[model samples]
Target: MKASAGSSSMLSHIAYFAIIILLISFVPAERLGNAEEALILIGFLGAWRYSWASVNFARAIYFRRFAYPREKERAVKDYASRPGAAHAYFLTTSYKIEPEVTIPVYTSVFTAAAKSKGGATIVSSVVDGADERLIRQVFSCMPCDMSGVKLIIDRIPGTGKRDALAKALSLISRNCPSSSDVVVFVDGDSCVPANIVDQAAPFFTNPQVGALTTDEAVDIPQPGFFRDWFKLRFDQRQIMMCSMGLSKRVLTLTGRMSVFRADLATNPDFIKLIRSDFIDHWRLGRVNFLTGDDKSTWYWLLKNGYEMVYLPDVRSVSMETQPKPTFFGSAIALMVRWFGNMLRTNGRALEIPSRRIGLFVWWSIFDQNLSIWTTLAGPLSAITAAIFFDPIVLPAYFAWVMFTRYMFCAMISLFRGHWFPVSYPFLLYFGQLVGAAVKSFVYFRLDRQKWTRQAAKGGQKAPRSTSERLKSYGSIYLHVLALGWLSLAVLYLTGAA
Candidate 1:
């Protein structure tokens, strides 16, 4: 039954692709004259804007250095000894079932916390059918004492998984002593290093620091080519963006790891806002929740005039996986859901009257939608220049421009001492094409389903996993080429392409 349904979906997708190809082939070349030329010019302008923004963001990251290990230890000792010393509870949220790769890291975190002089309390919240059995199976494998960890396995009625998590945190806050210092939210998949708490401890030195977010780095064993490329590119982009601090007013604190003062979490207005129906809304004035819960929390904290700091030295390693053969389809489905949520969040945000919030709302909209404009501009510009402009010169120039930009990014990735495989540039270009198609499908229709994780393929895979998959799809490319040639021949016979 499942096989038949999967087959039917594949057929439908192929049919849709065929129709699009036919439509594009039939588009009269002459009609692309002026509009295409205009798009090409617009594309150049958009590309220039993106380049400048990226550079400024990169500059910001470079200058904003955090404290070293020894410096951080000193700060932590000072804060721990203060009159009203900040005590933090490590709140770990998990769906009863978690990935096997994360278990070891979670155990390591508990071990580190136990060794800390200040002593951190652990709150493990589990939902659904996830209970003592599942937790024991995963946690027992780790060499850590589970006695200090407080576990809650209660079921949440009439709420989604994410909502249940928020509720659990809220409940935890209510039960804590009024004088408790801080509440640090950490995803189950993330593993905190031994010195992470010490590094982050200093941010509390500033009375205004309501929350602090650490830089997230991924750790994977024997990553495939595409996975390595993605990590390098993504890390560089994130680092550059963080450095700029352009979106400081609306900076997204990653959900994987962040610490907030307990007092802020106990705020009546904040708790009310999180628990309200408005939380269901996608866009909250100047606060965007497009990326997920972390963004929503960051938006709320910033809007309330609370200071949020980015502590690069406070690092946590997260486990990640590469996209499989059906990656494009999955990507489109996920992006559609995210884009719809973002649009909804933006709408909610516009209701706020604060000027700073208003600017943030508008900027978030622009920044998030930049890819859409660039994607459309690329193809339209290419086809238009091919029609009216000096086809040879313009097309070659555009290709060179794109290649140069990609090469520069690749170089930067390498300079950052991250993995930049030889075929990374090609993968980057392919990724852009995939993104354009996904974005187009998303904007054309709204999808309101929660994103589902794809199950990993069984069996051990080679390090060149993506490359192997590409080779496997080589036959499909041949079939596509044959079809393309047949279509072109038919077009010529009918005087079309």
Candidate 2:
């Protein structure tokens, strides 16, 4: 019997583009343009990404719409009556978030906690006393049955997320009822989907699935470029996550909302790692994790061989604010923080061999490192061709990019359940090229970490000690060297040098 499920990739997917290029070559024109080799290289990279993305996109849809439903049903049915204590703990951390965002968030949370079967605990880890008061007021005003629910206020200094989470985890560990229970972490500005608990808690019934994170959508009250940008990002996230979900693992247990089995969440070692996780850089000494608490949890789960699920249908709506005044500024700030977290853990995570971590999951992590280089290849190649080889290459490159990216967006929109905005193509390329640059920057300066939301206070400045200063200078040299080599290779490949 002939097989048919999976076939063709990279060049196979973009043969039509090649055919179009070939057809263009036959036209009566001067110089035939410099798009041949330049586009071929660009075409291959784009095709590979789109090809891989297509596979993930399909897998994501199957898992979310069909496969996951079957597995979830089996889990719910299998463990329906075999449980002992099925308590859930809602651990929410709200620090410096506005009242308007916090109130509705806690209200939805309190309601979710109250509705769970064996009762739940709401541990509000707050920095400001006002946040605690707001939470209490919301809990008090809630109309649901409060008999089985327990409320705890974990007040802490405005240190950082890690400290707050560490304290909250300690509280959960101390009062955890049973290993069969679940612990859900909710960010302050996020509202859980209706019946989130009922939908998510059932997945933990599967013994192999140690944790699960749901999809997220922006619910910002104010609308603008930032809002649309966030929407596009979330759309991309949902597909990628769903694709990862198929392999019984996901790259992240996102901070917006994620559920962990009580046994895993309450482990002392796990709590300790969350509180103080650091990686030793060969050159930069010890790099402490100041933010990206979500990353710490992900590394722990992956290291422990825990299976993670991505619940695409059950999504939490997060209210986001632009961290900087301008979109470009805010984007760079977040990407620096975001990609830094990934790069820091990525080296360590890659140390886990494929046989142990599963091949697909291992490759997914490896792809992160590869993407920073690969994403830049097309644009770099296109620019080189346009500058020296042929000016017509620019127009051809732009046209090809617009056409392919729009097609890519249409597919994403089909899966995302929202029509991609007109700016999707431009934003897509801008994010890819700019994001690659940011990733390159972060990969070198992994030790330089700070929270994007916090004010630039004097004490929080990056280390100025001699050793740190020496490393900072080395980072620039290394970044320049890497890009220089990349540019040289692109030139060599394009025959421009």
Candidate 3:
């Protein structure tokens, strides 16, 4: 009966949100002409914003109360290891363009790995339906002396998006040989630092260390308002969440770059977890729950008492491309998928005997959901507040909210030793408004289950040429100018300026 009550509550919550969204669509703008309508709008928006702020404050307090006591002794001990043999694995799942910038980075990584008495392996897992020419291009970019570094490209049978990644990991686990001690996973586009092995090697000394992830710096400067805003907001959030140790439950270990023990990779159960078809089946309504590859791996390791370490020193640089038109759509889809997956994994975590894992699961859900809700409420609150209050004050209030949120984000970035970009606060505000609007649309459509390949935000095609990239940047400039004009027009029309 208790379980039934909880299920009913969840269903009701979904239904309430659905009804609110539907009502919003039907609300005539003309109806909001009167003071009463304005008051109603103010009440709605104010309540939502306050709720969001309250939640954020609550989470901040909770994190402070349960802050993981950083073990300085353990940190010191982990840093004391002599640089031993290192192994770098350039893991590529897509049959796409041979990344020119990445090749030199890989060469440097391998040289460093070899000097550290470590070996290197290049693993490529090809999707069966991907272009053959693309696969050949990837092969052409690799060094010819395939002896010291093994190259394996397996054609997986499935059309699933993650199938290629699973196949690559499987091949690495099986063919890389037991002699290889460390398995560093780097995506095709990721540039590795020369000192990556030196920074990451110390973590392996601890038996509990199953995996390690490093900080990623966005390579290209953000071109336009949208791209700059998103990059700033995203980078700041990642810094905060990572510093809070939230990445321990990270589902996608960032195909950008990370390192793991070869033994962990070789585990049959780990491979099975990564390749699970649970999500596909669940999306078809065949199952109530699903789990993704990376999440499953973390779950398995935690269940079996293995610890995942994060090293801020081992850094990777990734070139930032313009956001595609489908970028927001893809983000919403991914978040919805993760919401369902987290529910299932958190359930499993609850059943486990360890208190630490249970705590991690609880905090992970709280952190992610609360952050998303806060972002959504930002624009909703601003629009709603405009209805009841003098329109002139709306922009100031909205600006305040944006600055407050950005300040928190900037603090996180600073704590991580990164310079907070001057343009970040404005970009964060714009990005939040756009993201909230897109997510609201997706939520109402109830089509979150469908999978769509993401396009570049500026509507540039993949494998963008230099000229195309330049054009996309120009488009961004035009967009910001248009938005500025629109904002001024709205202010004038509303008699708010």
Which portions of model 2 miss their true places by more than 4 Å? 1-30, 33-35, 83-85, 456-463
Q: For residues 81-111, what per-residue lDDT tens digits would candidate 3 score against the true structure?
A: 5444556565654434344554544554444
Model 1 over residues 1-497: C-alpha lDDT tens digits? 98996777567545644644555555555654534445456456557756755565554445344323343465567676676534556777665434475466567666656544455666666554544456556556646555554545445553444565567667666656333366677776778776655566665665666777766678656556545554654555456444533333335566677777777765666555555423332221122222256656765776666666665545677765433445455445545555555544454455555575546444545555556545545544454455544344344435444555456555556445553444455456555555655554433222223434423121122325764455335434654564455445433432234
Error of 1 at 180 (Å): 6.9
Q: Which residue ranges in model 3 land beyond 4 Å of their true spot?
A: 1-90, 98-116, 127-148, 153-161, 175-180, 246-252, 279-284, 287-292, 323-354, 358-361, 374-393, 409-413, 416-422, 433-497
Per-residue CA lDDT of model 2 for 1-497, tens digit only, reads 12331233234436635654764554434553445777678878888988888888888888888888888888778667665547889999998889989888988888888888878888889988888888888888888888888999999988888888888988888875465789999999899865877887778777777899988888866666777778888888988998898998899888889999988988988889999999988898787888878989999988988889877778788988888999899888888888988888889899998987789899999999999999888889989987877766765666677678778777889987766556676677778889999999889888777677775321123556877668878898999999999999889888788
Model 3 scores a TM of 0.62
TM-score of each: 0.68, 0.92, 0.62
Q: Report the Cα lDDT for candidate 3.
A: 0.52
Q: Comparing candidate 2 with candidate 3, which one achieves the higher lDDT?
A: 2
What are the lDDT scores of the predictions, listed in order? Answer: 0.54, 0.82, 0.52
Model 1, TM vs. native: 0.68
- Candidate 2 backbone collisions, by pair: none
Residue 327 of model 3, lDDT score: 50
